[model samples]
Target chain A: MSGYFKRKEKWHKKYLQKDATLPMEIKVEEVSPQMSVIIPQGEIDMGSSGELRDVLHKTTKNKVQTIIVSLEDAGHIDSSGIATLIEALKKVEAYSGELRVVINTKKIFNVFKIANLDMVFKIYESTQDAKNA
Target chain B: MQKTLNESVYIQLSSNPKMATFLRNNVHKSCSMVGFDEEQTDMIVLAVDEAFTNIIRHGYKMDFTQRIDIRLKIHENKYFKIILQDNAPIIDKNCIKARCLDEIRPGGLGVHFLYTIMDYVEYTTINERNALIMTKHLPKKSRTKRLSSVNQQLLQTLLDIGRYVHQILDLDTLLNVIVNEVKNLIQCESVSVLLEDRETKELFFHTVLDENKEVANKLRGLRFDSNKGFAGKAFASGEPLLVRDVEHNPEHYNKIDEDTGAKTSSLLYSPLKVQKRVIGLLGVKNKISGSFSEQDVEAVTAIASTVALSIDNAYAHETLQQTIPDLSETNRIRKEIESARLMHQATLPQALPSIPQLDISAVCQPATEVGGDYYDFIRLNENNHAFAVGDVSGHGLEAGMMVSMARSCLYTQVNFSNSISDVMTAMNRMVCGSIDKNLMMTFLFAVFNTQTKVMAFANAGHPYPCYYQAKSDTWQLIKDGEFPLGIHEEFQYSTHRIQFDKGDFVVLYSDGILEASDENKEHYGLERLLKLLGSKKWMNAQEIQLAMLRDVRNFCESLFHDDLTILVIHFL
Candidate 1:
């Protein structure tokens, strides 16, 4: 059973494609030396989640004290998209940095809720709301 | 279960990232057209997106110019099916497993979403294209129209064959797959792919398949000119030809049927072209049913392109693998020969012996390759001096080492004994004992007594030395034919005596001088050497030596193929 799971893991790694960039538009805005905001538009699924991860990884590596991800314009978010946020959240917490996400759509929020990561991350109504908090 | 209206739509898109939005819109419209709500449509659209992105990222490796085809079909307003196809190497579909979503990772989620949203998802390959077929169980709705499904089994068959061809890199296996697929598709009695030898341009039977095993076995070894048969006509014209009756056709070449003992009733020949150049011919013989048709010609022509591309790729791969090793081996041998050349140069006579009665001059010019040629002058006592000119057979490191070994043995043996025969016998025994029979040495050993004016010399398969007596004004070659050194161990070597007078000359040389060939392949033989020496007899030893070398150079304009060494002695 362990060997079967290992093979299953290999299959996932093979089929789950990753690229240097994604198709959607992603904007990174700097608030200060230790704070930043990432705005991703359109669908954040398998095809575009890689770009989201790239932005989040850069912000975490820069040792930002507070990183805000705004998903107001995103129409859809799949499991891979949710996993990208979870991965970034883990990196930010490791350095005692704060990661806050602002969701305006119920569909994209439901994806995070379905993955049970709504409680794992700091969710707000908007980027301004999260920055004020 | 009642069947209702069947609707199908086909869409083609380039493998570009921006095309994702266009594809999503079409898939979403496709779901609603089948009477699905917005929420369920989004789930179905996302699944199709994931599958398409996987094809672009992994299958095409993100080449945006490649084409992708999608077929959306709704069956009875219940079963919605999507088939996506792309021309890529066939990957094993069985190994595709959705990740266990328990592990929170950035990847492995696209496949999970695919498996969760779709009712039944499957992966397959057709031709050289990877295909993903996903089916979703639609919510039941009221509809009462009956329709028939489109027949595309032929397309599937071509896809299967395309997959087989591109997946195999080995030329032999690819040719076999081609023959088997052609035979199965056309239902022919025999199939063969005769590839032209790129250098010879002769068509040889690379793969042959026949129901009659004996005929197939005979045809496997058969080859002929590519311009002789109906197949040749197709190859020459770069077109497909279908002959319904072989006996009635004037272009039919019956040599293959006669040689293989198989009757030729009909033949269909298609030229396999890659990049507009015909590489080979694909021929099918005697259709199993009635006769060949235009449809059969079209089918064969279609697959020939795929076959030609695969064969060319395989040939390129095989040539690359072969060339790398050959280059490295040549480099290795070249370095060894260079080192051997340095070793050969060190073992030559550094300075000629200086005596009051004799003027000795010697020159040993090495060739490009390491040639095992050596000459030495050793003073035995106050009045007598021993000298030798020898050549080891063959070239490179082995021959170089043999010359070095013989030099050491000659030096040791000449010191112990003054007899020319004793030094010759000892040198022969040492060569025979140390190395194998393939390598041997031709040596001429001579001891000159300056006081008595007598030259005693013995030959071991070496060319006889040229002797010019000033008194007789005539040249005589000291002739003796004996086995070269490293042959017979106990063979007795006899010494020949020559009385020298004032102004006498004797030339000791290796066979390279006598056998040197010009551009016309004519050897600079003994007659040329004698004439040259007679003309330069008035000059001193060194002058005559240079004159002889110049004459040989004039005879052969190119570089000498072997090592040339000459030792000259003039009685002063």
Candidate 2:
């Protein structure tokens, strides 16, 4: 990795741990203009939502049109996380951009229905669909 | 109107049609005996037949094992009151609502009918007996105005049969849903509901003849062999049963026929189970002496399912009230453990920030609900160190509680005392006085004079500390304490003084640390721990502490049991 990438990785790792041990962290890569994916690799409760929101804000602010919030390694999601995703979706909608999600069914479907927002989105079966779109 | 007059009546019936007519006439006689009109007479008759049929078919099953007890009275307000009591089983309401009876065929028609006919329906199980309390108004002026054609017919039934789907729950309100719906749906003289027992396995008439209530005494809690009565058999087999005549059908329980003194021409029975467990039975008798339609079953079943669920719900609500205290106690205990864990964590320094020039680190873990170990480091003179480590007797909350007490007592006087032995003596004495005969604390305290490189310490009943010398490359366990903390009134604590140079490490740990276990239940023995300590090349206290923890963690792979605490201090 380049010095900038290494520094960012170290920053990401350093800011993530509790006490001094960084909790399992997600990998975020600003690989291209139209793509930015956040892959959480550990439990994602309300504690994780703040960091997720920050990452989404940074990506969208950079004019990333298609954002993939991937949970390939993420363990869980609380009410706040689902709410943050909805808010982030709304943000993307304002820009006429696409926001894609890759998560377990139980984690997202229940929240979507409980909040009555299941019908508002163009949901795909997998994250690959969002990336391809 | 309020009625509290104590009048109790108990009756048993035979299913002969003559007895059924007698019951019909007697109900009017009973109503007029209290000066009630035909409208009131109809309510009593309808409710009585409903109750009697439920008991005979569902409760007694053609055998006279239990009796029906009816408590009736004309209160001071001239209102007719009745409480039908039985000893059947009780069903939980939540479990009842959990079922889907809206399917093409339902298993709950009788309960729906009962709910439709009575002005008020109540089922209560006290001790072992079950009771049904149904009430109705005698005055026509009390009836609702602007009734629909279906409700008008049902109202007329109330005059002769007591009540139907429209005012079924109490014969006073709106079963408009079941009434209007059933008019276009099923055929019957009146619908009734029998409450089922989930625990004891008996069914009883909870809502009878739409308004008047009859309860079974010996009838409650009667068990069935799955295929006993038309209703009991249906409940056991998980199937719907249709009988054209109670007299002709061998499956029909004649006790209902014999008890009511009326031979029911036809009977239909099904189980009102919620969440797979049978809660009660729902059945319709003498279906207008005609061939019962699938839609008739469908419509009655629809109403029955909802009514069964309602009865189940009411039953559960009563039970939940009884069990709330137990549930809350469990929740309260759980919350206490959670808060105690937080308090224990808050007591520890979040970061144990680095102390300049001197290497220092500490840890505290326990074996159970709470921990008893404690270690505190207070800065003395710029070149001097003040520290104390204590282990309270026993384990869990009691010991943990004493740990806090010792900490508080030491903290209050350390600011005023400079002598480590004096502080230790004071602490020992305080703990001895505060704790009862069963509780106590063993403590070790020391003050290190950096300039002189001298360490002065006092020990109570606790174990010795082990020191590692870099010069000799050897480890020595030092025993410098007396017996445990609370035994004597003025227990004399011993003091020791030693001079130390750079690169020497002192390790203090609760016994739990050396005795920690892995998944295989093997302990991280003291010998292995000593060997691990002997192998570490690091002289810094931080490095030694971290290495020790790493070794312990490695030994306790997937199953780390017990609390392990270790503290290491090194002279720089």
Candidate 3:
């Protein structure tokens, strides 16, 4: 019963306040019984990097088999946000699980290209493509 | 016609946009009375209206109460002159520029139209007022009609050069543009600018331009004494020289032609002056069509004065750019010193320990951002309290770090041993083995017992602690100690015991107090400190400490060059 309410609260926060000046918003959806998808929107800067780090920490602690991060509406991501993503990816790889990223905007994708993180992460063009992989 | 030529009209009005239309209507009527056609009258009216708008908007910032005086005069049936005067902030003529026509901007066309229609337009500030003088030559019906376009071209060239000078700030780029523009305008074979070195009083060719690039390269950077050559003579005398035949001139420096392999037939040299002081020389050599004329000399003189003022501005900008980095480096070092000071302050004891039958007060003040002086009070057990004061050899970050290390080692040693001599021996070994070889610290440690009124003290090359007996009213200094820590680890330290009664106390200090100097370079020596402490022996521990610190401050006039630390303990 607690898991059902936690899922409901996550969906409620994702739809409301779409035009607010929040750093980010996260939505969790169970793709299968063993895997889940985390979609984040808006800019991921220094102010919101800590929230992303905590979500990744809790997901890996529960020993999920695969995690997918969809950044379809993310407009900008700075160096601190990129560093948090890299740390989370390393933690998932240490256990036998996998982590994938889905980026749609050129501005968000170019940040990874500039830092040469495009070669390290398993990236997909869309969330649909990531789910199939 | 003679009555019209000598007529003068003066209009005084406030700076308002509505007044511009009235002013233009009067100018149109005046031009028509002098037999100007409809198109010519319209152009003159437009130019006059724009000038008034500029004086009101830019000069006065649209303040309508300022007065503007417009004077119109027709001279000798040949020229029409207009002078507009206003009291406003002086405009920097160098920075006034017309926009590029290729960019397709809407504004900045007023100055361009004035330069195109008028034969001469000059702006000057005299006695805190701006005067803009404009003159247009009246068109004639003969050969002078053919020369009108040529005069127009000459004015256009000078305006173009003036605009270019204000655009480029790089010295090399500016010199290249000036030399090329002057050569084309005067139709001379070559043009060169020579700059005067303030230190040596010599002139050197800064930029040279000729039809042949090889000859120009050879003449660049050539130097001569300012009183020797024709160019030098023009600079030294602060006058312009037009030499038609160089062979007959005694001031011609023939060595330049000998080196560059170029012939010099005619030369015109003008001194470049700014505010009555000559800065350099501008020379035009060997006209292509004819010899240098009086008109050529006049034109080159006007160009020289404008170039001199522009060069001064470029030098000032370069100097300011060079000093920015030096200012930032000083700011960086100041912030680092502030950080080190905060770190040193965090290592000090927050509050003094309050034990039974003892009153204690300790204070440390650093002269700079960070200092090497330190003191601490620790509770060894329920019956004993340990106190220490130390002075490191130097100041700043390294000294502050050493003081912190000494503090941690002292606390660790006191927890394990109750004997003062044993604690000093262990602290000396730790400092000698771990710290830098050049660093040294002088420390004095003592443990006081509240039940027996017994104090065991060990001194290590520090200033002696002062012992005062209230019953006898005498002061005694304890100076018997071993070497300072970090110097010799194997040396044996001796512990001395003293019994204290009620109203007896001891004062421990660093060398900063004894070495503080007054304006006369007199040290506040031990004799003065002993006398002050003896007089205040009957006071409480905190009162005696404050009195001693105040005395030292008063003697030195509050000028402290070293870190001062003092600790006072009283037995009740």
Candidate 4:
């Protein structure tokens, strides 16, 4: 199956309210003591990348063995968004932990590929796949 | 009439992060109105959002109180133009380049997105304000619709009228040319204009052109209350009105017809307005063929606007001609200041003096206005050399005079004084006697004895110099200072001594370095300066100074607000 098949549009509709005032919605789920999954829904550009960075920083500080940044519901991602993931990878490496990202579409995945970050982080098609890895 | 390729939407918002959402919403709606597809609209909105955020972040330096003006219009009927203007300090356009993508920096992507998505992107400074203009080509369907038959002619005619606005200056001549053009275009019997007398609050016949010279002669110099006639109703309401049958219209006043004794079956009335102020009334009477149509009203309203602006400009020109004598004196003073600035820069040493044991390099960059930052090297004797860097408190000719006064006194006093403290004390007395107490200068003076490998330095309320230790590979600040010069005459100054090792260095700079701030309003702090200095220990004196200057320039893309002076001395 194509990676686009795992898009979380309905999932975003179920969890996130249509709020124009808020830049984006970030939800963190602790699957276990050693792992945490952070789902960010909305366009991640300079305006909202700071929020994602803060969440990633906090999750890494907790000493989680593995952290997954799932952009399955994200509509778009810009350079700042990619930079935030790179920063998280750096912090995770300092503690000898694992950092993974879940991108559902080739369009957004190409953004990471263009930045040459796809080779740096372990990417998956779904949150379940990221967790399994 | 303002001739434009397409209608424009203007928006002004406070420079705040939260306002980005509001800006995006408006941009989406405007894109839709211009018939952009979903994907294209999203891309345009993304580009516009990045631009707005960049303005709030970089242009205004996160200053929430400042304002940003945005104008969205169609250019040449085929491209959508976005003009964003801000009142912040002028940006250095050369620094607006997108960083190399390999760098992976967080802040440089906004400019990249702007260039990638928009067809044409330009950064400019207009009227001392920074403007970012971007344009994207419209889709095919919208382009054809914009080039319809009727609006094309209207656009051409308006363009011609716009040319008149810039070409003609004499009020009577401009009015005559516009009136004749309006009469020919509308095919009307006569076109008349009534200007408002601001002092009397009345309207008088400013321009009356008609085929019947008798009627035109009678209408001249006719004055009436601004709210008494058909023209007054349109002028007061600031709306264009077309009365098809003026004989039956209740709002129509027959005063003009009675005065000129001309039959008026129909007429179009438009308020002549400029910059949102109703300046006069434009009347096109007796449409020669049939009654006036809605299209005629629109055409008359457009011409009236252009006419009003031309008249206002002519009036301003008349006033400006009366004030031409006063402007020449202002220009003369400006020239004198420029020459003084050149002379001020000439006083500083053009070349560094060579010493056997020391490598020294110094630079002084004045602000846009003439400033009082100076540095000098005086070889007192063969073995002993004296160096000094100082900045007066303010800018302009007064500060320049203070610098020269301090320099002359220093050269004379350093030769006669016995110690560094004695030199400072004598300079302090001279400053106290020469300048005002409010204006003081921060100065640093040092003397190096090449044979003993020791230096004596004193600070007069100046910033502490950064010192690098070659052995420990650590940096420290040589700190201790009393009042600045011109503050106290009898104050006893103290001198400090430091021993230099081979490969040791000291960097002296003005406060402009420490206080230079980035777009985030974060200063190029002392810690960063010390870290940078410590990292570049392998570089020579000139290279280190260039690196420090380049770092500060990168930190603050705009010009430095104050004078910047840096002097580096390396022991080898």
**Best candidate, TM-score:** 4
Q: What CAPRI grade goes to candidate 1? A: incorrect
Best first by DockQ, ranked: 1, 4, 2, 3
- DockQ values per model: 0.11, 0.01, 0.00, 0.05
Candidates ranked by TM-score? 4, 2, 3, 1
Candidate 1 residue lDDT tens string, B1-572? 11112245555555665456556755775575556677778888878887888878778886554667777876655688899988877888766777765666566666777887789988986445688889987666624432212113223334434433323333454566568667867889999987775555577776898989689979984878878878778889999988888987776788888888999998888888754467787889999999998878867776676566455444433333333332456655655564467567667654456676897877776665777788888888899888888898877777888888898898889878757778888988888887467788999888889899888888888888888889989888878658798888898899888889998888888878888887578899999887776664454575566556656755663223335888889997
Candidate 2 lDDT over B1-572, as tens digits, reads: 11111222222223321123334433544454444555445545555655654554455553322344444544444345666554444534233221122331222323433344456666655445655666665454323232334333322322212112111222111232233233323456444445444344455554333211122222323344433577777677756677765677676766754555454677666666443345556666656647676645644554455444443332332233233343456556644653454355344443343444456776555543566777777776587767777777776666667777787788877887756656766776777777456787767788877788778888776556778877898988877767777778676666798777788888877666667777577788777767877775664564565456546755663234336567788878
Candidate 2: Cα lDDT at B356: 44
**How high is the CA lDDT of each candidate model?**
0.72, 0.54, 0.70, 0.75
Candidate 4 has what TM-score?
0.39
- TM-score each candidate: 0.35, 0.38, 0.36, 0.39
Query: By DockQ, who's the top model here?
Result: 1
Q: In model 1, where do residues sit more than 4 Å from their true spots?
A: A1-133, B1-333
Model 3, B1-572: lDDT tens digits are: 00011144455555654344345546765665555666666667756776787787689876554668776776665788888888888888876665454442223555655665578888886446788888887756421443244343444344434433433433454666677668867888899998776657778888898876678878888877877778877987999999999977776789889899888999999887643467788899999997888878877876786566456434333332233333456556755675576567556665567688887766676655588888888888889888888888889888888888888888788778757888888888877886478888898888888888898888888898888877786789977787788898787789988899988889898899899888677999899999888664355575566566656755764243436888888888
Worst ten in a row by lDDT for model 4 chain B:
B317-326
Evaluation by TM-score, superior candidate among 1 and 4:
4
